[model samples]
Target: MTDSNMNSHELELLIAAWLDGRLDDEGSHALQNALRTSRAARETFRQYARLDAALHDVADTSAMLDLTKLAAACVRPSSAEQSPTRAQESSDTEGSKTERRQRPFMQQMAKGSRVKPTSRKPIASLRMTPWYAALAVGILLVAFLIRGFSVDEPGTESIADLSPSEKTINTDAFSKVSLSKPPAPVAVLSSVEGVIWADSQLEVGHAFFEGESIRLEQGEARVSVGFGAEIVADAPCSLKFLSSDRIQLHDGEIAVDVAPWAAGFTVVTEEMDVVDLGTTFTVSVEAGEKAETTVLRGVVRVHPTKIEGEPRRGLLVSEGQRMSSDGKGSFVNVPQDQDEVQKQLGRLDFGVTGPYRPVDLSNTGQGLSTGDEDLHWQVVAGPAGVFSEPQYASVCEPERGYLPNDPDVSQWISTADWRTALPNAVYTFRTEFALDGYDLATMQLFGRFLADNGIESVRVNGNPVEVQSWVDNVKYQAFGDLQFRFVNITGGLVSGRNVVEIDVRNGMMRTGHVKDPPLSPIPNPMALRVEWYAFGRQQGIAQADDGVRLWRRIRDSVPPMSMLSYAGPEI
Candidate 1:
């Protein structure tokens, strides 16, 4: 009889989407039933609905003050006095019922003389006199005109005066606003506890937004966004706050749990500005460059301007699907390996298929010939498909395919110095290899790439660090003469020099594109937490033949992580 619910944001969203426009529909009925039946959920639903209406109203009317005064009466006190019930404030309360009586949607919703949601009918009609209503409508028109939107950038809309006593949708305002140049910088949006400040002190001359994610201009932040909020950051990028939970990326990657009815938000950037949206997806922006969008659950429409020519297409990604553009399409999806990362970083309680193999360098169970050169590695975990698996990261000689300096350069990087780079995760590194300047082959394996740049932290970057990477949800195949793409990021920026130094380790390469035989039996499916410091510090390889000597030392330095997925609660 009672199932008091709503443990997270996703549940709230599910209820919201179900009751969205047709507040009188079956979904609404079910949600309302759930709310009314459970006292705890009743207030919770009311609060969420209030916030939703506020955001909807803001979106519906982004004009300026004088013009804004004419917006939906919900913003004005006078109208509030005349209207009863916050329910009427909802966008669900579309056009007047006098006209709705003739509307097909209404006719279908109504069952003859006995109309459903008759109780809601009163609120929709809670109007002032015809003259005042006319004035309100006129204001609504103007509200769409000069609302607070930037006009400094190219392609933006303009607002005109309102004459009061009109009931027009003023669709033209959308076009103007959509086509006009970007509005001048107003106060950055502060929603759901997310704020950004890029003032004089912060001289971040270059900031880009491609798919759906946020890139900081300068200062740090403490943000808390709803689930499925996407954002990206280009190279020359670093986000070290007290905590980075609930944040998305436009150029890099992030994972979020966007509950069904809950809203999904994305931050897309190109090189100078950041755009925000609500949807389920991941955003990748080239470091300081382009943007890409990948949709997992909902649609994410992005644009520097939502008008014609300036770019009108948006990536419409859905379940098992993806859409992209040259930094155009706007959709969202959680990034790869996000769940596993969360487990390792946040120490979250998670699940995994067994055969719990540890990630020690020791080759115990794995039968590897002593001093075996020429190794191979591959990633295999999809047919059963449990979590978001990362692609195989490969590392090898920098041959003609990926370098320009020397194809014979060995020990691409000073392993002795890798510990000095101080990576940001167990995943960031830079090794040195001799690669000649040549074009990439028609085929190239690309996915998630990480490195430990001779330090305590690891760097995580995916293939094809461009906006399209996020939009397409795949690595870009390059066909260029050998050069280096050393840094791979979710935001999609390739900086530094020759890329041969950071080739994927065996585990990092994809199995489907297994060009090399696996070096040895894939030891642990789990991501490793190397005591890079101790190991690299001693310049000692944990040789399998070193018997228990190496395993014991390696085991003591770090705890075992899930070999299945490379991310999860921090150990």
Candidate 2:
């Protein structure tokens, strides 16, 4: 029936048909149109959808009633059934002929059966009594209450709600103690991916209460427990929430970062308990194996939970220490393996600056130059002095003010003019340095490329490095923002006179947005200059007194840019 002609009862019947997957295309189209036009219709549909889900859950859980038998009982005819009419008999005869034509083998097999066959059509229609109808409504109401189902107004759905088709109950929301435990939320899932549970359904931004457990069958999750403590858990793990400050890791690996406020945070493994004393640590527990705890920062106290009659002494593990436990909960201090330690620490940028020397090519009296700011050519440091003398470049361009592109790429020019500089072409910044007895195998080149939406393709002694790894985001102005990368120059380094070439695809003439018209090279001038460039043995680089020590100081880390960055998809 058309939506305009569908009465309230007809709409409800259509909903039931839709729930039962019996609604035809035309009826479904009409229902969708009605939902768009009427708010009440949408609400009613949501209520019925939730009701259907609850009914399925009930059917799966309850053993007292067989749903298939109940369906048969509803359609079964009583002894008062009337005989088939002549027209009905003719229809049945036609249906039998059609079935035979469709499947002759099945018809032949059925014809040989000893048991008498019943017609596909029922002998009589069963009418529902008022009591039966009322009982169904009462059951639906009770189910809705038990499921805590409610119809939300338009545009009120939570951001974390995925889709109704994949709906799984959020056990965290239940207050019924057996199914849902703990009175308050102890943690919140900050982010999650490919995560499904063996025990309960979990979602991002959902508050997790204590006494609840989550099994990470696969995927990863970053959970924030207590004040500032965040736990990044990988797949094949199970975690039981004990309290705001404590949890039991039944299996798998988890990296926990506890702030000062959450100093007493604890993670319980099968072997022992790892108590965080304002630290960042990783606890890995394998089934039937000893639990390993690695302290990334600060300190932790590992205590044996399954000790004998005597009191188990808590072992204080300081920073850079690793403790391995025996299956029976005896933790022994073991030498920390750097490679193994890095794996447990995840994406830490460890300190690497050391045993090498650096030569500054972009300095005064040094070989830094340019032919013409307007010309598109490389200004190599050589004879004839066509390349400009090296001068200090400033990130704070007070005189020139802000160059408009994206607000994030705003920079200052300490010496050169911010505008009317660098033509819309590749500007090669070449620098040469000498090397001696220093170990080139352990050495790496690290520096920033300062240009507005520019800087592409880097080559060392004619060998090309992976631009994706060196350049953080090529589609945007990152190297221009003083962001440095520890470039791996494998086979690019030699004994002396090593040539490092950097190609700059200056985005002076083009608008960052793809939709806008491209500007001509004359009017669109971009400011370009390298703030700093340095190369030496990896050990010669300076180390900062903080976090994971790395070879170079990364200025400003930014996310990667996309190639198909149009206004919308399919454009």
Per-candidate Cα lDDT values, in order, are 0.27, 0.50
Top of the candidates by TM-score: 2
Per-residue CA lDDT of model 1 for 1-571, tens digit only, reads 1235435364465466744543445556556667767776777777887888766444323321112334554554563355433443444335553222212222332333434342223222311112222333334334545785222221121111222121122134444211111111101111111224332222221111111123355323322221212222223233221111222233443322232333433342432122223334444546544455444444544444323455444434443333333434333333445454334334311111100111112111123332222122222222122223433323222211121112122112212112121111123233211112211110011122211111122222333323111100011111011111112122212222222212222121111111221111111122211111101101121121122121112111211121112111111
**Model 2, span 1-571: residue lDDT tens:** 5667777898898787777666788878888887888888999999998998866444322211121334544655463664443224333444364221111222334354443333333332111111222333344445667998652232221111111111122223452222111022355565677887675665554555445567788888877553346788888898877665688888899888776655778898768889989888989998888898889888999988767797768899987888998797567887687766667566732223222234333421122233222121233321122226543343333211112122122232222433434333444556566665444543334443444334566788878866652212121122211232223344577776777676654342322122221232321233344323333332233332221122222212221121111111000
- State the number of backbone clashes in model 2: 20
Stretches of candidate 2 off by over 4 Å are: 1-182, 199-201, 339-571
For candidate 2, what is the TM-score?
0.30
Q: Cα RMSD to native, each candidate? A: 30.5, 26.3
Name the lDDT of candidate 2: 0.50
**Candidate 1, residue 428: how far the Cα is off, in Å:** 62
